[model samples]
Target: MRDTNFLIENNAKAIWHPMAHPADMRARPPKVMMRGSGVHVSDIEGRTLLDAVAGLWNVNLGYSCDPIKRAISEQMDALPYYSGFRGTSTGPSIQLAYELAEWFEPEGMVRSFFTSGGSDSVETALRLARQYWKIKGQSDRTKFLALKRGYHGTHFGAASVNGNANFRRNYEPLLPGVFHIPAPWTYRNPFNETDPAKLAELCAAALADEIEFQGGDTIAAFIMEPVLGAGGVIVPHESFMKLVREICDKHGILMISDEVVTGFGRTGAWSGARLWGVKPDMMTIAKAITSGYFPLGATLIGEKMAEVFEADKSGLASIGHGYTYSGHPVGCAAGIAALAETRRLRLNENAAARGSELRQALLALQSRHPIVGDVRGQGLMAALELVEDQTTKKPLDKAKMADVAAATYEADVMIRVSGNNIILSPPLIVSAADVEKIAVALDVGLLSAV
Candidate 1:
């Protein structure tokens, strides 16, 4: 066995974790995950915990996925790496692209552009949106509109279009020409609208107003998440996406769905766009693409967009953007295996059933715990927003939320605490018993906070 103390000390000394302060790691120390199986993970200290966050909202199939592991091993041994750039590509990459095209055909996606991860996928979509407009002889259309509190990823282009200030404040002077409208979050909004349907209409009107104000001809695309993920699992009204789609179509603006978190059956559907019966011009996907076994993402192009690019006679459609590992053979192999298993197990159906049960349990928790102000999510992706006062809806302080997270960890449930929200996105394969355990552990943590 590895020396836990030595490993922790070395990690604190040498590593700077993402979304965390370096100094804080030395003081509090980070959990060193040693192994994982099913939906549970073992730390270096030999403690096992339910991974409710599913390794940062990925890992839909959970750990010990034999098919994915075997695919990766076989691919690495046969042909580990190959450049998909230019005219050169590998067999696995080509196969995966064909499979994805077929899989996303129901959502009107006919072409797939591979990437390294979610951020890359978002960046590619943003660039492609602008390029698509330029190719259509509307070069002035460069602005992007997105819903407030939506996350697109950390890349410069994606960060510019991100709706959350927390992700944007530090990185100022982001790409220019990006605007945001209020999200269709009924729990909190500028309209003071309690009714979800009304709020969605108001939000859609606001989007239309923004497009008109910016001049529809000047806007290239409007990007958003079907269900906002990193910004606290904010599930909008059922009609929200459809309305946005209509508005975008009317204005000739491309609609880009940032499905990084909602793709691959996380939202009880093959894709979030499919969940709402809305087709986007472009869709960014990652995380669950390879079941977190290998880093792989793709920006899917809609049939219309693909046709435009295909019909372009100019050399502009030749494309100048691509990554070295855009379609790593090993990653594609893993993705192929993961997709097959996802279909065989029918994980989307399981996610829908488990998600309903989980959401109901979370609502029950809100009724019992004064700290839980709101419970919101779709499918397995969910969040519990804590508040100091139920009447006024005052959010819980960061320190208190940290305490709650610590308590949850001690209770053997690994959840993610972002601000006052405790996010839970267990693997899609999570059983009903697993959901119960998560709820029980969260109850212990909430009670401790009280």
Candidate 2:
């Protein structure tokens, strides 16, 4: 076994963790996860816990996915890396693009632009949106609109478009001309609306108003997550996405779906766009593309946008933006294998079944624990919003939420805590028993918090 103490000591001194205070890591050392298999991960101390967060909501196929591992190994031995830039590309990358084109065909996506990860994918999509507008002779369409509490990753462009203040506050002076409208969160809203359908209409109207206020001719796109994941798994009303799509279409605004979390069956559909029967002009996809086995992402272009770019007589259609590892062969190989496994296992159906069980379990927990202010999610992605008072909906203290997360970890389950929200997103392949196990662990943690 590795020297746990030595590893922890060095890690504390050497590494600066993301989304965390540097001093906090030294004060309370982070868990040293040594290995993972299936939906369980083992720490350096040999304590195994059910990974409810699914490695940051990416590992849809879990850790012990041999097919993905084998594909990566075979690719590494053959041709590990190749630049898919300037007319140079590898066989695996080309094949993977073809596969993704087929996979996302239902969503009207006809072409794919590869990236290194989710942030890159978001950046690619945002840049492409502007480029598309410019190609169509709408050079003034440089502004972007998005929903509040939506996460688009941490890149400069993505962060600028991100709706969450926590992500944008520290990195001020973000890209100018990006506006945000209130999200369709029924639990709490400026309108004090309780009815989900009515709230969705109101939010849609808000989007329309924002577009008009900004001038539709000046706005390039309206970007959003179909179901907000990092923002506490805030699932919008059933019609919210469709309404947004309609508004975007009416305004001549490109709709960019940041499906980094909601893509690849996490939302019980092949893509979150399909979940609401709305086809976006562009979609940003990553995370579960290779089930977190390989870091890869893609910005999928719809037929409408592809046709414009492809038919452009001007040389402006040539995209100058691309990563050095744009289409790494190993990542593509892993993606190919992961996609096959995802289909073979029929994980989307399981996600729907297990997600239903999880939602029911969480709702029951809400009944039993007054601290659980709300339970919201779709498919396997879910969150329990804790509160100090049920009537007032007062949020629980952040420290107390941390304690609850610690208790859950001690109870042998790994969950993600964002503020007072305890997020759970197990692998799509999770069994019924796994759902129960997660519920039981959270029950213990909730009891401790109480």
Candidate 3:
């Protein structure tokens, strides 16, 4: 029995993958990923896959980077784990926090808090918002509002604040007092209006109306993604986000920007909040923090909010929340190294250049394929929306779209499919030649699907 077969059999017999049924997986064993280098990953069968989605939109530095690997190794040898409690912190942890804060201050960000991952980071933001109001004597201010079709994380608090109904279907009893508003998907145009400024005003007014209807005094925060990620890679007009900021300010609701997918060169900028100029009270980041070299996430709480946490009304009872691995030494080390490498290589500038070329290439695909209804986004983060009829703007049947994605998986490239929207978040290190290869394979896959 070969090692590959042995590994597959053991995986089938023992492991349970996320979002998969065990019975079905037994028949069709999972792909055995063995190694990765640059922008490509290889399976045990010696097949290489172009990771267009950046290994769940985190592998910004791609795989097998010597610097990040070396940092992690050195940290593990020195000290691998630590708790964020007891008023004690490690060097890597403190340095990483300082670096993150510096990156945000120039963009008007004030302070930040750390967390284990995106879900917890978002939860941290929500909790801070509630606490801020509580300390200010607004006990009734507890409700939250989010945008529809957004993907924030999978935790209970995150799901309660998230707008996607599919994610909340199974769990009936969720954290109450969270509301959802229309997303900024201009393609679908739920408001049934164009004219950028008018659209922005309408959307902003709707949010204000919702806040007023709920009683602005009762709402603590409004959470959203500047440019939605899993919610079909939808990009909003510049004025729309600005309008949202104004609305949040009017209602005194803290705006928490969930940039888990759009941070770190995904949108040709360090943070989507910076590019759009919609500064949030708190920012939840993950995915590219360590370039997928390790599992780490952080929640950046701005100065205004940090002040509330710093007052320490309760000597020992101040912000009684923490994770065993909140700032794991190894993860912090990787983060420090990753940020340095990003600056050294100017990856954000690279994203700006490649993203323009990639978007053009994707739009060109629409010219060749009628199914391609829309090609939109910035930097390496982009999406191609499929439609049954371009005139009607009807989405391809959900089941049909899944079939299309499964078929596309057989090709050389690995792309992420969200309903009729095919997402593309290729590694920042991808070159022009790599982009062309991906385009050719994706073109064939789209044609075959149609």
Candidate 4:
């Protein structure tokens, strides 16, 4: 509603960004997007660009998904809000819950504990894991395990299990007894091992070693993303998750798959767990659950936890955590419609087809661009890690990365530059031409940076 100059002048004055410095943002304001259509967005400057970030990796069906918009509108008119707390429930929430349970059944998820967003979903899952242990009479199993470079969320429990120090340093004194194992990243690892299968084994062994050292019985769960999203899209080997699953099973530890980004056909599969044929004990689903039409998330409970809680005579099985916006009617309606559209379109197959092309193009770019240190991704998610020196692999300067991203935007593609990594996660509806446009934009970015 406000003019561009009016909005830009007061952008950082009233609001602080999620992951940026206030002073720095005031110095250089972020882009203000005014409109979106299909997989493209238009900024206040009247420049339209391909949204390679996919609205923070949530807009899978893109801005033009009419079914979701209609559902939200209809739900707003019918029932704007309703609490899914103790006694009352909404129609949309109940239907969405059943849909989700059926959808994630392959991963063994049987029930849904709704939340407001990804962070809430993760926080709920963590709390649910701890409660499950307590209900099982293992109160001492309060610790958690996560893979290094794996990001959970911003909540205290999620941050404690987050492997990125940048997100953890300022929020110290986090939940205690949280340990991290080395991820199966081939490019950068303590092992310096390049072979995928071998690196997977090494990572699995590290998990086993951690369990032995920490006393597995004391650990409540091992939480990780099937394909790491925020931490440079570090996709582990095909066998890596299965290895972790086996380790968790052996230790009686719950496997909570953080699928906020990889869910809803983003990972070329129904879910990341299904991608590797490993069924986790729990899953945090959000982001694309409503296809960015509304904020909605859920901590999907597996059959194991469901059975324990449902059949429990103990009061410890009772859930003690909830959010005000949990199971919001409009959000649930959006999710139900989004899931329908996602399945009807068979977006998973499209992601597989398009992601293969995108991967090859990025690899080619890496071959041409000396600054490109590495390329890693699965399905629609991918990243280009930049370096100052090809031989030494020194990370590209942040200033240079900013310049590259700016250049890419100028060239009509909007990409996410996190740390030295240029992350690209276009909408699942992205076409072959869109992938080429992204590739071309990145080429321009690399040239500008160099």
My TM-score estimates for the predictions, one after another, are 0.98, 0.99, 0.95, 0.99
Which is the leading candidate under lDDT?
Answer: 4
Model 2 over residues 1-450: C-alpha lDDT tens digits?
557677976877788899999999988888989999899999988999999999999999999999999999999999988786767888888898999989988899989899999999999998999999889999999999998989999999999988888999998999999999988888878999989999999999999998889999999999999999898898888899999988888989999999999998998998889999999999999999999988999999999999999999998898989998898899999999999999999888999999999999999999999999999989999999999998899999988898899899999999999978999999998999999999999999998887
lDDT of each: 0.92, 0.92, 0.83, 0.93
Q: Which 10-residue span in candidate 2 carries the lowest summed lDDT?
A: 1-10
TM-score of 2: 0.99
Q: Report the C-alpha lDDT of model 1 over 164-276, residue by residue, as the tens digit.
A: 99899999999999999999888889999989999999999999999999999999999999999888899988999999999998988999998899988999998899999
Q: Kindly report which residue stretches of model 3 are placed more than 4 angstroms away from their true locations once superposed.
A: 21-24, 194-196, 312-317, 398-403
Could you tell me which 10 consecutive residues in candidate 1 have the lowest summed lDDT?
A: 1-10
Q: At residue 287, give the lDDT of candidate 3.
A: 80
| Candidate 1 Cα misplacement greater than 4 A, ranges | 1-3
Clashing pairs in 1: none
- Predicted candidate 4 versus true structure: per-residue lDDT over 102-179, tens digit per residue: 998888888999999999999998888888988989999999999899999999989999999989999899999999
Instruction: List per-candidate RMSD values in Å.
Output: 1.0, 1.0, 2.0, 0.8
Cα displacement (angstroms), candidate 3, residue 374, comes to 1.6
